[model samples]
Target: MSHPQAKIHRMSELVEPIATVTFSEVPNEAFLALGMRDYWDGYFAGRAAPLGQAPAEVVHAVFYNFADGEVARHIPWVWGKITPQEAIAVRERGTAAALRQLLGPLVGSPGLVRAADLATRAAVSAPTEGRALYAGLRTLDVPEDPVARLWHAATLLREHRGDGHNAALLAHGIGGTQAHVLMALSLGMKAEEFGRVHHLPRARLATVVDGLRGRGLVNADGGFTDAGREVKERIETLTDELAAPPYDVLSADELDELTAGLEPIAAAARGHDD
Candidate 1:
């Protein structure tokens, strides 16, 4: 049998793409409908809407990955263009439309309904302490539609795990830039590409890389050194452990059923994107 933590980890991997489709694939038109012109504007506003007009500093603290000042540039400003409730509505409608286009008949299948029910159970049962994003999301009403429910559940679980991940990073003494550097190195991504994605300047990226190299975490070739890999593994393992409590509400068989039900849906989402 898979380790219980491993099963929870698997659930996280399966749910990630579905949880993030709104950020990655949802059309600009969705945000445009609210008079938001920039993607990041919509992204910061929509995701943080659960927190009800949270300030930039609050967003930066919870988001945990953006470069310094990156969040401040959009937030508060985004709130001016759209209210938190409006942003939430746009995110839900857009995400639902996107899932329908991607999942087709799977959207209405009994399998989806079962998976949504199971995932929502686990999500709602998760502990909320110190998980600001997840706690914020949990306060919202659950969607009545299966597709929307599944998507919302995925988001809840995603943010729950993400908040735990931030804790793991903190426990390891890893700052946001340093964490991104470690991630890029682990994924074999070019520093330039990762830097562009996170809006880190080349010099700033190099500085963080150099700091890691000083700590013997990164090698000369920009990959994780032996110690670096171990640190990364430890962080991921702890993150999985922290994320496992929610799944405890499920019996072993129910966990299996939830994973099985989500597999095809996640695969369909992947295929659509690919």
Candidate 2:
């Protein structure tokens, strides 16, 4: 078997498209019902503030991938007051509805329940990390609906992993712009996509890019330097470490089963991307 940590993460990635694509693309109807952009802002703000109040400030924090206009649109709204249960409720409604829509047609498909079961079981072991954002969400009551149960599990797992990633970023002294840039370098995310998600001006981003090059973490043309690659690799290794607690529940064959189940579902979700 691969390293336990790697196997855990390897299965984790299989479930990510549900959030990035399905949950994201599904109407903000749930958020709208909760107060639209304000709820969106407050919900993400609460989750991102796990480490400290306004951990990286409202604008540049990466807990949720807000759009370019998102920061400008919602920054003035009240933050730090949104409760974790409130956020989780809103999140679960949207995610559960979206998954039901996306995966409903194939309900009889083999391995779906097994896949969700893997996530749900993994979640039982994931909350040991000392991050408030994750810990807060962890405290929410889980749903009984099958899809909602799966999404809840996936959410716990995602946030748990994300909290760990944020912890790793902070520990390495990496800031927001550079952190996003590192994601672009390692994951092939586009600068335009990052720009859309972060409200920072180009000049500020350029300065960060230049500094990354100066520090030998990025090349002149905005790719990873060898040193940067090493750092990125180390961060991923640690993320896997933090993320592994949940997946410890899954056997190697089960991990493979979950991955296989999510593959087609992820592809199906991506198929609808516009």
Q: Which candidate number would show the highest lDDT if scored against the true structure?
A: 1
Error of 2 at 199 (Å): 4.7
lDDT of 1 by residue, 1-274 (tens): 2347878889999999788877755644699777886888888888999999888999999998888898999989988788999889989989888888889889899999999999999999977999999999999999999999999999999999999999999999898888887787778885556753456667888888888899999889877889999999999999999998788888889999999999999987775356
lDDT of 2: 0.63
> Residue 46 in model 2: shift from native, Å?
8.7
Off by over 4 Å in 2: 1-5, 38-87, 108-110, 187-193, 196-199
lDDT (tens digit, per residue) of candidate 2 on 1-274: 2346656776567656665532454535555555545445644543443333343444345453342454544443534344444555566666666666777575545566666677787776655646555675566666777677666676677777887887787788776557778887777764435644345676766777788888899887778879999998888888888777776667778777777877876665554354
Q: What is the lDDT of residue 75 in candidate 2?
A: 42
The C-alpha TM-scores of every prediction are 0.95, 0.77
lDDT of each model, Cα atoms only? 0.87, 0.63
Q: Give the best candidate by TM-score.
A: 1
Q: Mark the 10 consecutive residues where model 2 has the least summed lDDT.
A: 46-55
